[model samples]
Target: MHERVATTPSLMIKRRLNATPAEVFEAWTDAKLLMQWFGPENVVTQEVSVDAQVGGGFRVVMRENTGERHEVRGTYSEVVANEKLVFSWSWITTPERVSRVSVTFKPDGAAGTILTLLHEQLFDEQAVKGHTHGWTGSLAKLEALFA
Candidate 1:
């Protein structure tokens, strides 16, 4: 007989932005634009570097109001202009726990973009919860950009 173990579920998040797919994609790939709305509310972006292509990498550092710094780095696995992007994500502090993130941009009617984000391979349930919180906050900031 073989034993099996259960795994944590992947996180899926969706948002609708009042902008075109190109604009939403640019906000993700362009370092300058990303820095403007990459982190949670009240978290200041200290540094941002992005190479928006397959096999390229990105790094973002944010400082909280309490001066705590959080850094995340990732490598691009797939990139489709204004359509989709897939990447590997790992925290600088815990590179051993690598995860994958995929984002798809779909045109909604004529002006809005429907953004779907799926984050998988999380190490544990705690990671899923933490990422859910972080992503929710980040997405809110991203949404504000188009408002």
Candidate 2:
């Protein structure tokens, strides 16, 4: 008999933006701005649907350079104006890929905003590492947008 196995991996990323919390939050809630910096260099996201309100859902198809497409679906679990966002996310390509993400926006002492991201329920160490880099790079793109 095969024994039960469990695999859960996670990654967290925090970034500071040279903008206000409201501005950062707007970038996320606004689909147009979100498309400006949501994926990798060769990947583009086509947002099929987005309902930003709490309990509302969103789905987007990410197309890679080679035209490979992946679908991501999520629903907003919680939202606080200019402060925090919590959501349940999963990839349609990977059934077991389930995660809850929390993002906090705080005002920096000076004139910036600190964005703290917490991603939980990954599948393995490799996934955690890959996602770390992926998230960091994406955040960089976001910073570029504000700059």
In TM-score terms, which candidate is top? 1
Model 1's alpha-carbon lDDT is: 0.93
Per-residue lDDT, model 2, residue 70, is 77
- Could you tell me which residue pairs clash in candidate 2? 9-122
Instruction: In angstroms, give how far residue 70 of model 2 lies from its true place.
Output: 1.6
Over 1-147, each residue of candidate 2 has an lDDT whose tens digit, in order, gives 999544466677888899999999988888788878887677787765767789998787778889898788899999998999888888897867778888999999766998999878877787678668767877989989888
Clash count of each predicted structure: 0, 1
| TM-score to native of every candidate shown | 0.93, 0.87
Name the regions of candidate 2 deviating beyond 4 angstroms: 1-7
Model 1 Cα lDDT, one tens digit per residue, 1-147: 978543655899999999999999999999999998888777999899999999999999999999999999999999999999999999999999999999999999898999999999899889999899888989999999998
